[model samples]
Target: MAARILIVDDDPIQRRLLEEAVKRFGHEAVTADGGEAGLATLAAARGDFQLMILDLVMPDLDGMAVLERLAKAGETLPVIVQTSRGSIDTVVGAMRAGAFDFIVKPVNHERLAVSIQNALKISALEGEIRRARRPAQSGLGFRDIITKSPEMARVLRLGERAATSGIPILIEGESGVGKELVARAIQGASDRRTKPFVTVNCGAIPENLVQSTLFGHEKGAFTGAVDRHTGKFQEAHTGTLFLDEVGELPLDVQVQLLRAIQEGEIEPVGARRSQKVDFRLISATNRRLLDMVKEGRFREDLYYRLNVYPIFVPPLRDRREDIPLLVEHFVSRFAAEEGKRRITGIRPDAVAMLSAFNWPGNIRQLENAVFRAVILCDGGELTVDEFPQIAAQTGHVSAIRRVEGNDAPPPAEPVIIESTLPPVATEDGLIGVAVSSGAGNDPAPFGFLRSLADDGHVRALVAIEEEMIRLAIDHYGGRMAEVARRLGIGRSTLYRKLKEYGLADGDDDDAGVAAE
Candidate 1:
């Protein structure tokens, strides 16, 4: 989670302060004496730095000029600009030049940290969506991959090298790990970028038609062969051929597949002769082909041929660093598509919870979760409330029954409520309570609210008032007057509910909340 950041400033004091702040926030910081040095370090680092904190005012090469140069060079690195002048003109200019954010000089630690996080999140979104500018399937390059984890970095490096030739690549990973995307990237980066790129899911086709599907069938070659069909091999002539779930190929078809790889020729069913095809073969399988080979399901020779330049893409959980990036990108994309453009980002806690779950279905599952969260989001940002199912999986206490159409914001902790079960009268009208099990299941039992303060004495009136005030504040969206009125108390009584319950500044008219 600690990203490397470059701090650029002409003044040593400012640089030192920023560097300390960055380090204090648990990130690695590299200092540059000025703008020129920052750019030089960036050039040499070769994507080593995730973000830059640059002072806008410098001698020869100012922050604005640095940003312009970066944009001209097609760099998407995020920059946070700083200046003593808090003028709107400077901020607008910096933002126009692609600065992720602008902060006034002598930065506040909290503000600087927030800016750094937002810039990183935006940088990640840029990295993932940059591929959209190109063709979705065929024209994507290694840079289009959204990954900050070293595991994926290694995979991309291997893939880039394999893309330089017509090497037979056997991509191996769990399902939905983006194996097909890696294959397309390799093909796009290869010499056959403009040629046909055909994909075949070997497992999805019928067992009887697998051969005909891959090698084509002549007109009336079989019962359902009504027309002369061009196979995937022929379709990918002079380009790349992707075989997904190759481990599921029929045993007999494996022999024909081996021959095709060995001689680049495919014999269509009912055809006396074989036709040669020029295509780069890239096969992907979630299973271990070696195990299949041992079980006599997969042909060993065919496996060896296809596995020449193997690239293994790690699953989403293995590369946890990519989750936040992918989630942010998906939220942005789905929000626009759903016409909820106000939903810009997800809360850090939501991202943290997502990062903790081991995605059994890999990237595909994570993407779907984000898409659903975006659609369910009712506010400007996504929170845990938007991901109730996932939160329950993480053992979060959201199991309490929800009232339809109730839009009260989620409490910091489980909001204790009276149970719907047959009530046992305790005192006055207060009934026995039940605690949520955090599993979205019925709670067995928990005692009623204790009247004593653990000293064999009844609780004080102020203590009971404090608890009621806190609960009212959370339930009523922090409206102080409404909280006091609901509790049948004066405004003075509500003010006493402040500091202990996290409202540090309680002197304002509505406790800093404006009238809605």
Candidate 2:
């Protein structure tokens, strides 16, 4: 297939010559004067070029720097590295750093043509594989959750089971793993689908207003209580109340929450008496709430009340087989949403690249990447360039180059791997958590910490803890309760840490609204 190729060279003569050669090889060629210009060109017209021919040594931002930047940015266009300084070491280094193909200067036309052909062929093959794996459309109801991976399939089964139980359910997973989606799916599948499905981010509410926001308040109860406010529990009467980040609720609020759940009644702030309210409660957090109980941060009674029906959603990296299906789903959805008729599918190579990435941001991140790709797509296909994060991690450029040439370095140790799966659930519906020896594919215990230490930029435990909490908050969609739970701390401690770190102070002033 004829592709648009980019050539990055400091020497004008070399650039022009390579351009002519690429054109002759049945591809359109774009040229960049140096490494900086090449990167600039790529950023400006991302997704326009399918492959790049890059010169290793440039005056500014040498090929290595460009490669590093691309890796950091997660750009994935296959790159062929050309250098006059061609020694075995240089070529090996380039390949290791993500150069697709290494070619010596004084280029040979036949060799260049052959390399291009090989890279394109590999690219095409990957595209075909992805197309083969992609489901035509996602399933409905709980299956709308979308996955072929056994891990997520199990979670969905539990979710489906939880839907009809008519009991409070707790969904647990890292932020962005779709706790909200799971909650919605449960509500949708339940008998109460006709009724309201209310959601409240517990952490987003101010400490002073947690009780009022959840259980309503009389007019003039507090300084900003301009009107009689109905709480989420009242709004979700006879339906579902999804409390996201339940770990963020203050201790006083937790006390009231337990009472409300136990008695099916809530006394609004400044109300004369408790009013009965009926709603199916569904709570989610990314935290280890059991640990919170041990630490005395969470109310044991409230934790038990909410943990009656627990569903743990698996992270994306743990279910990579589902990625292609999700990519297709998102691509089609975003294409239609953006009115982009040309954006029908992603390149197979792109799918492979995406599947290999450990998506720390999970499905939401993938959705965002696909949305961006669809908007940026210049053609019918979403190519490697469209998904920079995947590209960078997969080292697509280097791998492609190695395939295109015979003279390349042997493979190095893998820098990234899929995230480890959570402990399997026992027949009793409780997850079995235990440490395993790294005898097989299992990673060493605390491997990530070892990696951090090995990097030599050792962080203070407090700093690490702060960052962990921050990440958990982000992953759990700003649900502080979930963050605290995941961090094995109490909501109170989480709040204290947040204040100490100068992080979010649980003071989202306008977030006090009780509306879904």
Candidate 3:
């Protein structure tokens, strides 16, 4: 492959000779008059050139000074130092300053070609090493993830395979899509399962403290360094270091991070010596690192280093089929945690409602919904009444279908059940009953209640009082005096009925109503 070469020599004649010689050897060359000009060229090109040729002696900004600038700027382009005859000391110094190789004046074309070839080969090998190391394709540990969607299944399969590999892993997904969960599963499945799993939220740390937080700092490193602190890298030694929101790391911190990954060591703030750390890297980011790199907000080299094993966790909407399973799992888990033995499972109508929502917050949002529903559940099953936010959007009543088997389909139609509805005043100023499910031709009140309708036994008085009380309170915004006036009963009677129906506290009242 043709490589771009930069030649920096003070002698115009020597520079022209070197450029012509490299061009003939199947390489492109750009020349600079002096060391300062060479650096200026590199800075303007910004890593465009692959290799550089530098003459040791220069009037200004000597070769050693140029090498120092490259080191300070974190430029890794290979360099071939040129030295004059009897300048053995300068040649040795050039090598110590990080030159790829050295050549004497009146350079041999064959030796120059050989040196270039060897440098290119080493660079190629490093590139291959970056792309070669990958995790096994299977045997993932995903105990906490409950999913039935094919999309999620594929994600888990890939994650499992990546878990066994020792290379760095990059997980990408929207917030709440379980990126950290995937990271944990990968770590759990890895050989270092018994080792420490240290997690750091890169975006959460204060910008000024990010470096000290990741690389640690000795006492008196800065204003807040009253005590010595170990960094995440050292803490996760021989283990896994999960950097969530890694894309949010500042550019300066990205440089430090690249050095740590490339050299396997970190120099703590205010510490003279660097410490070696052995840790597996697993980074997660919601933002696209490629986009950031293009925008110059993220380092391209660091992006490549962290993206050895890429895994993407699909969002909840993309895998809607898994919602039911997730709901059931969360219900069971939260039920035991909340010590609610009667909360067996969610109703089919409630599940349908839940499955219909496009959970923008993903799995975490779903888990919170299930937990909240479990707390509100009064019967053995979680019904639509428990999930007001979902129910409000759906605008439907609970059909009360028992959870049949583990994977029963949702009910096709909602079952109408009469509940206590508020009373509305008639034209003649008398109380009237407004049927919640619309009036039916059966003419029998409380007909939908199987318990009350059995054997033609309609508990008319009890049902009327319940219905009247409910409607009155709802109509008058839960004002007991007005509810009593509308129902033609006293406030004492309204309170008595409310207590009898377990609505005394008015906690179960609809949010649209105001309680006095």
Candidate 4:
């Protein structure tokens, strides 16, 4: 079906241009001259349009204000902002206000079409997500799990099939890849959902008590058995039993577990009576069970029995495309839970840094980072400074440095430092020096310091030391002792450095301004 779009611009020529562009793609277009008229048309038509092409500078109502009003009214139609020539600030401001994308004046038809196509794609994906979340009566539908990636979707499908078949399932993935969430999703969608879903962490319990935990024990069974207790299997009868970290089960205990799973009965400790229990089983482990089996660490027969339906959850790094969505979800959840509404979103640079990192701990680590960032963030957007680890690990100095308003110049090109410094020395001494003037000629003894300062690489106190001393002197009315104390420098040394930097007697502020 052809998509319908609304074009809202004050200029007749621009509106006609956009209308022609929309028609060239075989789509329908509606045009409005200003924001008020566009909003009225939108309300009267009740979101009949699939997208909106809005002008950033309309006379009656601006594009940003219209967008804010639309968001307030719970309307989420994709919007593409149209900016005049050389209006980058307006374009960026529109984007920050939730515009899908922007196009400069004298728009290229090809680029405009591509942006429209992308907007339509985003709209379609959101529609699919909404449809996927619709509840099903049988509890065996796709709504039980939340995922967009093809790999996770395939796993959910396999899990759904296995849940109906009453076969044991083994989920394999890295730790914190949401293995237990998948297990619970399966249980929730199965016929046994109404029954108790018992879970046991094999690695968390002591080795001696694992058997008793899984198969129960009679009164006076072991040294501390006070009364007869039901095992996980018995407790989960007619339901599902999820064994997490199944690879951690000891060899001797594996034998008993294998027998209990094969047969529908368990022989409790110190009890002559054997009890029958019926339950579906689901197990998850991060270890390679096949390797363990080959090494005689895990029983092969037990592996086969549990491997009836194996599902693997891909790590977060493998599916980086989902990071943006996940960030939005987590930010909203955390903000609501913490009762803080000041934080609106994350800075673009921080998101880039987050996407670039190799998430060794998967989604769990990402969640923790977001939670920490949200807690430390004062208000507004979260920046790279909020996440020190991302900056440290990735060596990305700053995600973004905004040039406020139109007067500010565009950002400078990023400096790529390729150090020729040799392997760092163990002792506190300069290991290598910059060669200058001749082959391996270290001109100045402090050449490394000059290089670092010139390249704007100095950080923290050293970067601020010279400036702080000058500022303190000026603030303290030029008392040398007070300036030294405030700067945490000896009075004599302060005077020496001041003279060295040509700042003696307050000659020049530039002399004491360190590169940052």
TM-scores of the models, in the order given: 0.69, 0.52, 0.51, 0.55
Order the candidates by lDDT, highest first.
1, 3, 2, 4
Top-lDDT structure, candidate number = 1
Backbone N/Cα/C clashes per model: 0, 16, 7, 0
Across residues 1-516, which tens digit of lDDT does each residue of candidate 3 receive? Answer: 356799999999999999999998767899999988999998887455779999888998888999998989878788998878537777788888989999988899899998987775555444334323322222225744666678877888887888778888899999999998788778878898778888999999999999989999999988979999999999999989999999999999999999999999999999999999999999999999999999999999999999988888889989887887678667766776687856656776577777777899999999998888899888888976677665433323322221111123334442233447554433322232322332221221222221122122333677655655655554566676677777787766666677787766665343323444
Q: Report, for every candidate in turn, its global Cα lDDT versus the true structure.
A: 0.78, 0.74, 0.75, 0.73
Candidate 4 lDDT, 1-516, residue by residue in tens: 146799999999989988998998867899999999999999887545779999988899989899999989988899998877456677677888889998888898899988997787566556545434432322224543445677876887887788777888999999988898888778777777677778899999998888888988999988889999778888988888999999999999888888878997888888898888898889999999999999999999999999988899899888876676567556656765676666656776577767777789988998898998889889777877677665445544321111011223222442222345553432222232221211121121212211222222333564345545544664566667667777787766887787765567564333433310
Candidate 4 C-alpha error for residue 199, in Å: 1.5
Model 4 clash pairs are none
- In model 3, the Cα lDDT at residue 353 comes to 71
Model 1, 149-203: lDDT tens digits are 9999899999999999888899999999999989888988999988888999988
**Candidate 1 regions off by >4 Å?**
1-7, 12-31, 44-53, 78-129, 136-138, 400-516
Put down candidate 2 lDDT per residue, 1-516, tens digits, no spaces.
Answer: 456799999999999999999988767899999888898898887355778899988888799988888899877678899888878899888998888798998999999987887676555445444443432222125744666678987888888888887888998888899899878878778787778878899989999878888999999998988999999889999888989999989998999999988999999999999999879899999898999999999999899999998888888988887787778677766665577755646666577667767889999999898898887789978987665444434434422222223234334442222235664433322222222222122121221221122122334697657656654664566766666677788876777777788874467322412211
Candidate 1 has an lDDT of 0.78
Model 4: residues >4 Å from true position, as ranges? 1-144, 399-516
